[model samples]
Target: MSDTHAPTTRLNKRMAELGLCSRREADEWIARGWVRVDGRVAGIGVQVAPGARIDIDPAARGHQQEQVTILLHKPVGYVSGQAEDGYQPAAALVQARSHWRGDASRQRFSPGQLRGLAPAGRLDIDSTGLLVLTQDGRVARRLIGEDSTVEKEYLVRVAWGEATVGVQPLVPPAALAKLRHGLSLDGRPLKPARVDWQNPEQLRFVLTEGRKRQIRRMCELVGLKVMGLKRVRIGAVTLGQLPLGQWRYLGPDERF
Candidate 1:
């Protein structure tokens, strides 16, 4: 008989919660006998207590090491994730010829790398700048997971009121203050952001959260209209001098 009152969770879910790997990968590892619980080989569908010791085999580590993460200087008009409404997904540009000539990683482009490549976060079709696509589940969870605290920085060009051309407009002090701290989107209060003017027409926005069209909606609420938006940095990685529409592998030494 089992002690039904004890708390338990699926092994895969516990591994994911501990940042070991995604649930799918955990299942595969368990099937291959690459995952162990309390020094015993764990099987698929196993349930584990909170204090169970979990370990992964060396083969699993090597498999994870081979997974690639790519950084792209996304151009406007490309959807960040999947193709929709006839717009191409940013992943479509990860071909051999499109690899940045300035890439120093020396990683050869391979079609096999595209097998499971997916964007970690989103950049709207109309926005441009740094975009991350990866085959590694760990990297994906690190950047887009619910508890991620990575900072994404953007340059936003905006126009006050209705005029977009030949007009220099300043953001009202009150509106700018609200932009930095107080605001709500989709009926929930937003986390504080680091927003300030980069120039007369552009604002620098550093946010830790990526809600759909969050910046654009936030600007609209403050009476400013976004004319252009470009993500310049995510975590410690910047778009750098990578030309538009080109990509490079995230170097082994790089983190987040």
Candidate 2:
């Protein structure tokens, strides 16, 4: 007899949890007979139990390969997502005119590529540097998923005590240690971060979590005020020499 008490979840949800695709994409693949579970073609909304084998058709894989991921050197004043308070979204800069001439990818600019392209993570309007926009759900999920462990690196210029531009005050070592692992925000403890002095004026930070205004808030808690913030790297990818307000496709050999 079958174990009727076994827990089951929607096939699309299972696919999403497995990093296969977004739930919507999973539903589309199922409708197109591109998904198989336990050696049978899956249907939309099909329920799956633990350890159930799942497979994807080659056609589905081909479609996924066509989806694109774009890396942008975002400039300050542009919001990472939708337009708000008169500031344009960063996606507006993905135009052909703004495509980096040095982009090594063979892919050319196309209007269709913008249809579903969206920022995978937020880069505050006041902050600048690397911002990722992608049409591939897999890329989005991998970078910003709730359980994601990808490291985001930033160069932060901070002021201690009074606000004096270009003046670097001596920070207590205990405070620096707190910035690395002992801070909490919104009443929740923060994950340990890699924080160190890049220069007398700038601090280099590497964090696996992205909380809203997290770095800035952490600095404030440690008696430091952030003057400027710029994200430089995410996972294995760096902003590199991508010019400000320009974008480039993620190369075929690139991951993360």
Candidate 3:
């Protein structure tokens, strides 16, 4: 059987404004037969009147739609979200002229009144770099949520491995330098890390995996302990010229 009755206005828009759910949510409810107009099962995308009655099941409004997104130039030691019994949350640092001091718009920072908005991805307390926080459910799902494909890039200062280990007395330093240049301690010869030697003292490490203290652990494995590690970029967004301990809004299309 098909619905022959028609409503005066769009079911989705009316339901959204009336029930405070977003348009996308209203559509989902209609498709699942969870929304009713005048006690009749509403069809998806149907028009309904503003004065007409609209109903929605409470469960359909997932909190994801209302989430807020924030990007922070986190300094070391701050936790990404909720404070532990002792630590402070990273969101506390979202301030004006502090994080985005040099940004073009020169907007002012104010407290976000929305509750439940939180960090989407985590940078360890010991590490300082770019951190993203969100109130949007989709952003959370895209970042820390399972199946995230975003890439995080970091800058690291490491010991020069070429001079440390390789051929010994029997072999000349030239041969040892050549042999050591490509070798790494990661079980299989490490995949060619996108490395750019900044100087004799530093090397850049760009990686895709987000393991626990991954960069530090990887550096330890290669015999060069990390002197410093700072995340400079994530996906296409860079922590360029942004000051530390501050945050700003992530514009649309700024995906990692």
- Name the top TM-score candidate: 1
Model 2 vs. true fold: TM: 0.94
- What is the lDDT, from 0 to 100, of the residue 39 in candidate 2? 90
- Candidate 3 lDDT over 90-189, as tens digits, reads 8777655455655554334455523556776778787788888765555555566445566677776654445532212323354323222454444534
TM-score of 3: 0.59
Superposition TM-score, candidate 1 onto the true structure: 0.94
Give me the runs in candidate 3 sitting further than 4 Å from their true place: 1-67, 96-101, 104-110, 160-196
| TM-score against truth, every candidate | 0.94, 0.94, 0.59
lDDT by residue (28-60, candidate 1, tens digit) is 889999998889999889998888889899999
Model 1, residue 87: distance off in Å is 1.0
Residue 251 of model 1, lDDT score: 94
Each model's lDDT: 0.91, 0.90, 0.63
Task: Score candidate 3 by lDDT.
Answer: 0.63
For candidate 3, the 10 contiguous residues with the lowest summed lDDT are 163-172
lDDT of 2 by residue, 218-245 (tens): 9989889988999999999999999989
Model 1 root mean square deviation, Cα atoms: 2.2
- Give candidate 3's error at residue 144 in angstroms: 2.4
Model 1 Cα shift for residue 37 (angstroms): 1.3
